[model samples]
Target chain A: MRVLGIDPGLTRCGLGVVEGMVGRPLTLIDVNVVRTSAQLPVAQRLVTIEKGIDAWLDEHQPDAVAVERVFARSDVSTVMGTAQASGIALVCAARRGLPVALHTPSEVKAAVSGNGRADKAQVGAMVARILRLDAPPKPADAADALALAITHIWRGGAQARIDAALAAAGRRTS
Target chain B: MRVLGIDPGLTRCGLGVVEGMVGRPLTLIDVNVVRTSAQLPVAQRLVTIEKGIDAWLDEHQPDAVAVERVFARSDVSTVMGTAQASGIALVCAARRGLPVALHTPSEVKAAVSGNGRADKAQVGAMVARILRLDAPPKPADAADALALAITHIWRGGAQARIDAALAAAGRRTS
Candidate 1:
């Protein structure tokens, strides 16, 4: 399954696409950062983000999109922008009828590094190892985006198995 | 000038359109609330809001858009959604190249009711008095939306005057 992951932020939104299923090796399709100048009006910044996300969606056309869930408790000044950016990503995917999932930062960290409390360096190292890249993606946000995509693929596959098993059990009972 | 005011929320987004300039009787062109089911996914809910705001912009063709500025300190449980909704509203207006202004609740209250800390009922009553309406708009959100529009007109007029004066002073000094 192919997946696009978004590490949402107003200043630097990270986009990463990965193609892989649970057991197979993953391939990094692409990674990009959508940056907007703080000098621009917030409205225009949002428009820039929307357009960037739309272009990415058009090019990748992933089966599902994963966005990093935002929490208000994060950096007070930036949390709102993060939430706003995530909203744009969500609506952009939904407009095209693409399935979207939100995963928390810890969830992404745990999915790749086997530790929810892993530091950024650790998470980046794990992502590099998983994708067989010689070095971790730069700007940390890009690596986080890749980690989110990897998490969704692995978790989604496991959930699908559970769902199929439940359906089989229901059929037998009927 | 006609202004489209939006009170951004995921469940019930209030919209109001007011037309007039400073020191003139403001006319209420329209007021409505866009309600989205809580059961709906966040992405779909955002899309609903985007469509609602878009339709209002298209119909009113307002000279400017006034949106209530969202603060993270207000209602921790709902602030993220509020910010997201506001973001969608911002993008909708920016995409059309329509000037957008964000008015704080206190600013709206002060402009309409002469009190920065005015309660909802007081603000509603002041809005009704300013617009010459028999009654304030239905929901508190609706009234707040109207207040935002009124505030923008008044403040925008004052700002324009200040700019004109500054320009004249610059020319004299030059």
Candidate 2:
């Protein structure tokens, strides 16, 4: 199944799409970074991100979407912008009736690099190797998005199947 | 000017519309809460919120939208869902070419009450008195939303005019 991964941000959102299924070689379909000026009004910046995401969704039409779940990093820091961007991605996929999954940064790192605590460079290197690219995708967020997509294919795909089976069994029992 | 205030949330989003100007008594246009189940998926919840915001905007045709800006409060830690919801409110307003303003809780408190650090009860009481409501709006958030709308009317309206003047002057100078 084709999976689209989004590393969401207000200033810069990374998007990557991968075509693959279990036990199959994955192919990179597209990768892009939607960048908005910080000087723009908050509303306009969100509109830019929303339009970019919409364009990608229309063009690529992935079956599933994986997004990095927003987490409170420090004790008290503003994550409103990131959360806003993530909302856009989730809504885009969800409104289209596609299954959406949120994978944490550590989860994506662990799935791709075999270590949850892997640093950015390590994750990027692994993504490059796994995707068989001579170099990682530009603008770090892009590479991270690719890793998220790979993680979803390897991890969330199985979980989704299990969830569906459980639902089916639940219906039969009920 | 007509103003729509949104206290965004995933579970229960508060919405209030008020019509008035700086030197006039404000009139309550409408107020309601958009309720969504916690059991719903994140995307579905956002969609519900988007629809609700759209309906309000369409029905009221407000001149501006005032949203509670997401803040990381030291006393609490449940701002992520609120931030996501705030993003929906913003995008809904922006996409329709409606001017949107974000007011900090303290700003709304200061505008409605005499103190920025006023408690919820204080804000609610003030909101009821200012709007000439016989009773305080239910579920606190709704009251807070009205306070936000009032704040924007009394505060942001002037600031928006000033900003427009500055932009015009800058263009002329350039």
Candidate 3:
């Protein structure tokens, strides 16, 4: 399945598209980052993200979307912005009736690098090797976004099935 | 000016509409909460919020929008959801070219209750008294939403002007 991965951030949102299936070689369809000026108002920054996301969804229609989940941070301001960006990504995917998956940072790291505590350089190196690229994607966020997509393609389907089974067994999760 | 205040949440989003100006009596045009089942997928939950916000914006056609600013809390999951909802509210306002205001919980309390550290009960009481309602709004979220509107009507305009000036001076804030 073709999957779009998003590393949601207010100032810089990373988008990566990959196409593949279980036990199949993955193809990097595209990778990009949409940026918004901090000088702009909060609402306007969101508008920029909305437009970029809308355009991406239209141009590169993916079967599923994967977003990095935001958790509480010591800096409330930072977490708030990340969560907002995540919300925009979720809305974009849902509007098209695409299945959305949220993977925590550690999950994505482990999926791509086989190490939950892998540093950024290590994760980037592994992503490059996995995709057989000479160099890793730039701006870290870009590679992270790709990692999220790869993780979703590699693991999300199985997890979804498990969730479905659990729900069937009357142990639904939010 | 007519202001629409949103207390953003995943399960229960509070929405309130008020009509008035600074240093004047305010009128409560409407107050309501939009709820979504936790059983739904995260993306679907966001879609529900998006629809609710879109409808409110369309129906009220408010001159401005005010939303509660989310902060870091002990409950990471809860804060994440709240922040995401805040992002949706900002987008709903920005899409329509309506200026948006974000007020912190403390700011709202200070504006409505004359104390930044006021408890929810105190804020609720003040909201009811300010709007001349028989009692406080049913849910605390509903009252908080109204309080946000009252704060914006009474304080946010000046802050926006100041921010605009700062931006023009090349000292913009995020």
Candidate 4:
């Protein structure tokens, strides 16, 4: 399955697309960041982000999109902006009827590095090794985005099946 | 100037539109809430909200938009969703090149009532009195939305001038 993962942020939103299945080797399709100036107002910044994500979605057209979940308890200063960016990402993907999943930071780290509490360097190293890249992606956010895609490939299948089952059960009950 | 105020939330998003200037008596053009089922996924809920806001904008064509600023430090559990909703609201306005302003809770309260720390009932009462409504809008969120519009009418002029000056200064420096 093809997946596009996003590390959502107002300043620099990371985007990475990966193609793979659970057992097969993954291919890196694309990796980039959408940067916005802090000098701009939040509304304008969101418009920039929305356009950026829309362009990416149009180009990649991934089957599923993975976004890093924002936790208000973490990072008091940037949490609001992060959450806002995440919302845009979710809406962009969902607008096209693409399935979207939210993976926590720890989930991405553990999926790629086998450690929930792995440091940035460790997660970056694992992502690079897994994708057979010469070096880890820059700006850490880019690497995190790749890790999220890998996590979705590894976990999204099972999650999708669970969701389907739940829907079926709900239909039956109704 | 007419202003559309949004109280962003995932479940019940409050919307109010008021038309007037800083000193003149304000007229309540519309007041309502866009509600989504909690059982729905976040992305679907956002789509509902986006459509709702779009309809309002199409119908009213307000000169400016005022949204309640979401603070990460407040209400940890719902802060993420609130921030996300606020982001969508901002983008919806900015995409149309409409002037958008974010009013903090305290600022909205202070603009309508005499105190910044006034309770919900107090703020609602003040909003009713100012708008010449027989009763405050139902659902505190609805009243709060009206209050936000009232605040924008009272304060948006000064804020717009300040933003324009800052933009001009930035252009000169660049």
TM-score ranking, high to low: 1, 4, 2, 3
**How do the predictions measure up, each by TM-score?**
0.98, 0.90, 0.89, 0.91
Instruction: Give the DockQ (C-alpha) for candidate 1.
Output: 0.88
Stretches of model 1 off by over 4 angstroms after superposition: A172-174
Residue B118 lDDT (model 2)? 96
Q: Cα miss at A3, model 2 (Å)? A: 0.7
Q: What is the TM-score of chain B alone in each candidate?
A: 0.97, 0.88, 0.89, 0.90
Residue-level lDDT tens digits of model 4 in A81-125: 999999999999888899899999999988999899999999999
Candidate 4 lDDT score at position B7: 99
True contacts kept of 2: 0.78
Model 1: per-residue Cα lDDT over B71-135, one tens digit each: 87888899999999999999999999999999999899899988999999999899899999999
List pairs with backbone clashes in candidate 1: none
> Lowest-scoring 10 consecutive residues by lDDT in candidate 2 chain A?
A71-80
Candidate 3 error regions (>4 Å)? A73-77, A157-174, B74-77, B156-174
Residue pairs in clash, model 3? none
lDDT of 1 by residue, A41-150 (tens): 89999999999999999999899999999988888888888888898999999989999999999999999999999998998899899999999998899999999999
The CA lDDT at A69 in model 4 is: 90
CAPRI quality band, candidate 2: medium
lDDT (Cα, 0-100) at B42 in candidate 2: 84
Q: Which 10 successive residues of model 3 chain A have the least lDDT summed? A: A71-80
